[model samples]
Target: MASSSGLLPSEPRTLPSTGFQVVDASETIEEETLPGYHLGKYYPVRLGEIFDKRYRVVGKLGYGTTSTVWLAHDSVESRYVALKLYVANLNNTRELKAYECLDEADEKDHPGKTLIRKLLGSFQVDSHSSNGSSSHLCLVHEPLGPSLKEILDLMPPYSFHLGFLRPVLRNILIAVDFLHARAGIIHSDLQIANFICDVRSSDKAMFAKFENAEFTQPTPRKIISEEHIIYTSRRMSLSKALPLLCDFGETRLFSEAGTPGEDIMPNVYKAPEVIMHMEWDYKVDVWNVAMVVWHSLTGRPLFNGRSADGKIQDDRIHMAEMVALMGPPPLRFLERSTRMTRALWNEDGNWKNVAPIPDITLEKLGADINGYDKEGFFLFFRRMLRWLPEDRPTCEELVYDPWLMRELGLGLGR
Candidate 1:
């Protein structure tokens, strides 16, 4: 949230992406401080540190491979904000551009569309630490609550009302549409963790509904870890519980001529195009979001690709599962995946390198998909889980699909 106090708003905020932060070739590390935080070179920012000359860090929100987010008070604007600081080496100018495009848009610009988190501002700061002189890019954003993954962890593994999922799915679809069609960006990473609950939703009943809910706490890492604080929907209520898309580091603007790296999305939510190393577009986001909706509704993954031994099956296994459940991959896609020809398939378009994994069919995954319009639910799935990316519906189409419509009480399709 941009502060109304006018500190940053008072200044000329636009700046170029270059300058500062030299890397020494001889530098090496023997030990690291923060675990689960190995994505980039971390800056040793102590608590209560003033950032970008204005915002004061209050608490750490969360940390990821590339950056660490904090709950900050923008003293200049006199408003709370989400402050994301990225390590110097990551160089996330692409993500910065994505937010710049979104900054020009608002919910009012698109009538009846769902809301997405807004980026307030961004600036770079140079810090000299024991690790060396590093330049960090700090982005200011509207504050959001815990993630869907955190929310789910707060509940019993299977405890959630099916009806509670409709708004979330709708909201996510709206954000995806905004990213794909409006912003010309693809959310290369789409997972439960990337969806933050709107902490300031005005819906009282929505917040009240989860008052009695339990939030799972993280295990002991450092004694000062945020895990020590138990967060219920009520206690950590930054505002409301409306779900919104967050995290743009992994996002990329899609184009026909440009071919992004094949390994773009998370393993669990990867699209078939990504699996087969095809030049993909917005369709990958559709595949990812379908799985997200499924998990949100059922509290179980659409594809539980890992076994009891914690061995997540390889891509060949994943491809076999997808093929068994959704039928064969498109012939062109199979032919294009020649890199894995010996390990995944044969000349006959049949599985050769992988054995069939049991209980992976759509019927099997949807067995517990009751207490709602089951047929309509599968209809949405079929439209989304297509073998060919070109054949899948766009975000605009899926948002109005009969299944979403039924859940939204807008009537069913044939």
Candidate 2:
């Protein structure tokens, strides 16, 4: 039942206890699922039984909920990495000690190195029989490309471009300011399917400009160091490039943290002060980088919801459909957001805790709110979707915004 080429059946399977393994409804299911296929959260890791010996696994290519990526081949740097494994259980020793103190603070105070996803070593195997052993941890990355939601499903859209979103938001604000000032950490899951890209400069710019195209194929290999085709040709040459916020498995560490009102994100990029319990910090990663730059300039999702067999919706009904498209939540942002006024819109202030509100508004989250000439991108999405994370803005004042220095004209002083 687990076969989208993730094989698993020769009898004797037994995974559950939450390691997941229940999607066998008699096979036949397809809808472009691969990049961490999913059932309960991935249950397949077989690149020829973990490719015998000194690192080689080369396959799984993506996953989360405490890690699982692969595309190995590094018999000591013969190159072709992107490992990421980690999820062996000891209940993830404080996220593997904050990913080994952000890889030793990127070998002591970065100057390049530490844009997250670059571990490159960890091993321990045994316990699938022949009497107990268990410790299978792993992480050895740097295989980029294919995930900007697979390059916005192979591009064909455009607008917004502060010179390619200022070098992908200056490499996600230098990896979130080196994980909040050199490894204090706080990623708490940034979106865009955890960004990655480079596949050898997307096949030398698709072999120097569309060589025999059909959306540039070319994968015969021999040097295409993944970055998922250089971030799918940087979102097909900047479709308002923004995504780069990566996955640090619900990250945290501004000194022994977590439980700053749970629901850590992905519940529609959480953060209404961690869904109304408040006490959060790193401004809940600047309101999840303003709801992933308003779903990369509105491909839509300033909040959405649909299920009831409408196919699994309800992330607080897409944050009450993004507070009815960015409007009602201000009563001075519900009295200075004590996690949205005493734990989410209750006590007769109703909103039935921000239900499925969106009938739609803000000229429908934009894309021509009064004929788009990009009016400072909806005033930088209303100053980064402010709902009182101390009135948002601050990734160094959204990297000096003046509409991002008059759309990259310069003057971008820190």
What lDDT tens digits, residue by residue, belong to model 2 across residues 1-414?
Answer: 222112222332221223222344344232113343333232235433344365545344445455556554444445455566554443455556767877777456453244556655555543342323345456555555566656645554522233444456556656676677677878777776676644443232321122122123421211112211111111222223234445565687887554545767676677665665556777778777766655654444466466657677555665576677665576655664455465446655557754557566654556432222355656765776766777777676666666555545674432
Q: For candidate 1, write residues 1-414 as lDDT tens digits.
A: 233422222322322222312223243221133444432265555445678787865455666667767665676677667778887666888778777767655546663224667788998877664446778888898776678887777776552455567667778888888887677788878888888877543432222222112112221122223222211112344335677788887777766322734678777788877766667787888899887877765677776555446676567667767777887666677766577655677788777746565556677766765456666667777888888888888888888877677765686532
lDDT of each: 0.65, 0.52
RMSD, model 1, all Cα superposed?
8.9
Cα displacement (Å) at residue 328, model 1? 2.0
> All candidates: CA RMSD in angstroms?
8.9, 21.1
Identify the leading candidate in terms of lDDT. 1
Pairs clashing within candidate 1 = 1-141, 1-142, 5-77, 154-214, 154-215, 199-239, 199-240, 200-239, 200-240, 201-240
Q: For model 1, state the Cα shift of residue 18 in Å.
A: 42
Worst 10 residues of 1 by lDDT: 224-233
* TM-score of each candidate structure, all chains considered together: 0.79, 0.30
Error of 2 at 70 (Å): 7.6
